[model samples]
Target: MTDTPSDPLKTTPLHARHLAHGARMVPFGGWDMPVEYSGITDEHMAVRTRVGLFDVSHMGQLELAGPDALAAVQHVSSNDASRLKVGQIHYSALMSPEGTFVDDLLVYRMADEHFLLVVNAGNIPADFDYIRSQVAGFADVDLVDSSARYALVALQGPAAARVLQPLTGADLSGLKYYWFTHGEVAGIRGMISRTGYTGEDGFEIFVPPADADRLWLALLEAGAGEGIVPAGLGARDTLRLEAGMRLHGNDIDRGTTPVEADLSWIVGWHKDAFLGREVVLRQREEGTARRLVGFEMVDRGIARHGYPVLVDAAPVGIVTSGTQTPYLKKAIGMAYVPTGAAEPGQTISIDVRGRPLRATVVPLPFYKRSRS
Candidate 1:
């Protein structure tokens, strides 16, 4: 029997709406979230080809405001928050003292002294406490966990703006990628951001918890003719993976650093000081022993997480994330292999259930959406 998340699962405000839509619920990140609706492939293609919606309310939100809020944010975040203009958002990582990832998150500059942090669900409590601890020396830095008060929904794909533009007063076209504005979406006041995890032209709508279902159902009705389907975590993961986005716990965690994960772009080397600056700087100078890279199967086999990756019939590294990409129609995965074998076009082998399957290192993102 499949284990449902009824006993200790934290359901979102749209939990009933998911059930009403015949969604398959599962335990994810300490919450009862939709794993699939129509199907993973269908939903994945819907977002790639047309449009799709994802209820990402399980993500945690932290509100940081006060005199030293900027300092507090800069202390723990790997990116340069000092450069963020009001209403702009940037992808960043929360690093530990050892230069390893605490959690990868998005930093939203709401105002001069106010910032909002969108973090992964499972690391909320730890993130909150860690952030609080970081700001202990800074006076007047207030950390509030406002995750329960808001519901987040993502409308993604090429038709995202087309479907969402009519319902909101915000100039959807004017809202550039990684920027947000306070506007009414479907007559409900909230923050509408032109950001998404699907690596497409999309928007993440943040609204009051009580108004979640209304906006969800309304969006569905509005996009019924546009091939907009309710997507779940299954499609979400594949889409992000195809886009080369890293999962917090899988591709990056306490054991991995930005250097090894090929995420050096996020680190602000110019910044004076941060949690893991010293180690990251050293790693940048000396070079990482292993690096993350993308690969596709040469033989017929699917590589899963924790699968042994070998270069010369010996275990060199392990697979972090792997999947049969629905859109790519091939078995692709990301793994941290030795620096020598991390180059593109380098052939390697993945042990799939004791069988060595030949694979080749490709570029980071297996697929990129065309501008056309």
Candidate 2:
């Protein structure tokens, strides 16, 4: 869900295509990317109701091969990678010694002794270097930064499978959530994973750079029935926020530990050892002083990032991510607060531009799709 963007100097294969679609471009992470097409609200609703495509090629990728791949993955990741069977993916965090995030990532078990890591684009170089150093002492593990070798696009929403089924030979129905398969898509060989940041049913396709435009157009045409549109960073951010997905720069960062961020489910606590295992375990058993919590504005105000969160008119924490979601049409946000005050139904104050605004802590995932 950390779609803050990356590779500031590079553009994905679909850059020109985005321009042609009359997109408003913005600088994200390190790349020039579309902030919106049509408009943020329009694009956001399109994804919520029908389908939307996103150019996510700026994300970083790493390959770990050899007999020690699983060991290497287990060492750097919070999730238990050994439990992943072939074609399966698990959400994980690359942890530091203190159990803070190096980066949140996806661990794809491509094979028994081979794996692919999808990491944030801005942290690509840092992530690769860090992982390589961590696994340097391991026997027979080869780490390679293969970021430029592939292009990625996410076809997301309820109508995603309906749209993608016509473009790929792979059985979209058979690919369970977080699973992937190497298949032919729009006549090109690619890997399709049934995962998305929007909390919708969708697929992220990894294809060669040369085939990006082809695949992009093919999907647009295939999904025309569903009013498919090209969504950009603006919609992506709001969508993920509604889904309660953590943004790397805003919601979770080097300063925040996973447990404090309310993401302990990604940790494989039984793994005996890992970077930051000690800190994480301690926090797991004994809770942190402050915890991330979700809230909706009780008054008319937007509780933006960096705003002070107050208790009894005194500053205690800060807002990490907030927005007026298009689909939900309500102002919701997340913040870190004293653990005692983190429970839902509790009331808090957000310092909204010099004015203290009242808000109520609410359950996470402000929106959930009906899966009937």
Candidate 3:
């Protein structure tokens, strides 16, 4: 659940389409988004077994271009932007000087001197300000916030390719994962990417806002026979949780560093000093006091965020993310605990509603799809 902002709720381009599908609207990142349609469980299952469409237009899109675009991106982001080839996408983190997450984002290399950054909805203003500050030192880079101009729709599931292939001339099979190509999808020119947060084979199509509803309706009509359905934030959260994909505000935040969050892999230690690299290097050399771990409930109760985690009956940390996953059918959660106690198979107790429930540390990504 997102905190209600002081500003009035913003609606996505597909707001009317969501309502027409009988969606349950809720506040998310200051936007009135669909939490569920049909039902969370049903939508979750659809994405896992078949296909599901999601209106993720609330995500922010920032465009960077000019001779110094590469230098500008490499400065604000932890990952090496120089490593990304054109038409490729890389997951990266933007951090504060103190080494805490500003937001996790996707860096899309559209051209040698052009890039598109997709950042979390809630952090749009902050992220934009942060990036602008970094780019100010460079003379040649030009930045543009094109978030409102585009609508992002994620078509995710095992059958996603089959459902989407016929509508676009782009060779869906030829497009490798983590790559995108500009093409006409459903007769609308857009950037189609083989990326998704649901841990399924899928595509994230970025289309003009005016063409959003038309492309949405077209995809639905074409995919109806393939069991495609519209999914909402509720199912999205559960799906990502099951995939062990961290949610920005929950699993990671400004209070947590990449090292403590077990995401040091995203930091390009070899690259020239990016923001937060010094602190990250120190953490790497000294090691973190606490580490994030995945766990499953050994007891009956469902673990929720902020619930205290106990080690030998003493509070060690609190749960960051937890839920009863529809596809996994298990109570799973992620938490930050002392590094010494972060090993798999370590028995811990979670304080759920003042009662301690037993749980065990387990490997992340409670569920993995069969590649074959």
lDDT of each: 0.93, 0.92, 0.93
- For model 3, residues 1-372, the per-residue Cα lDDT tens digits are 244456788999999999999999998888999999999999999999999999999999999999999999998888888999999999988888889888999999999999999999988887888899877999999999999999999999999999889999999999999999989988999999999999999999999999999999999998999989999999999999999989998889988888888888888889877888899899999999999999999999999999999988899998999999999899999999999889999999999998999999998878888985
Candidate 2 structure lDDT: 0.92
TM-score of 3: 0.98
The residue pairs in collision within model 3 are: none
Pull out the clashing pairs in model 1: none
Candidates in descending lDDT order: 1, 3, 2
**After TM-score superposition, what is the CA distance of residue 34 in candidate 2 from its true location, in Å?**
0.6
Task: Compute the lDDT for candidate 3.
Answer: 0.93
Clashes of each: 0, 2, 0
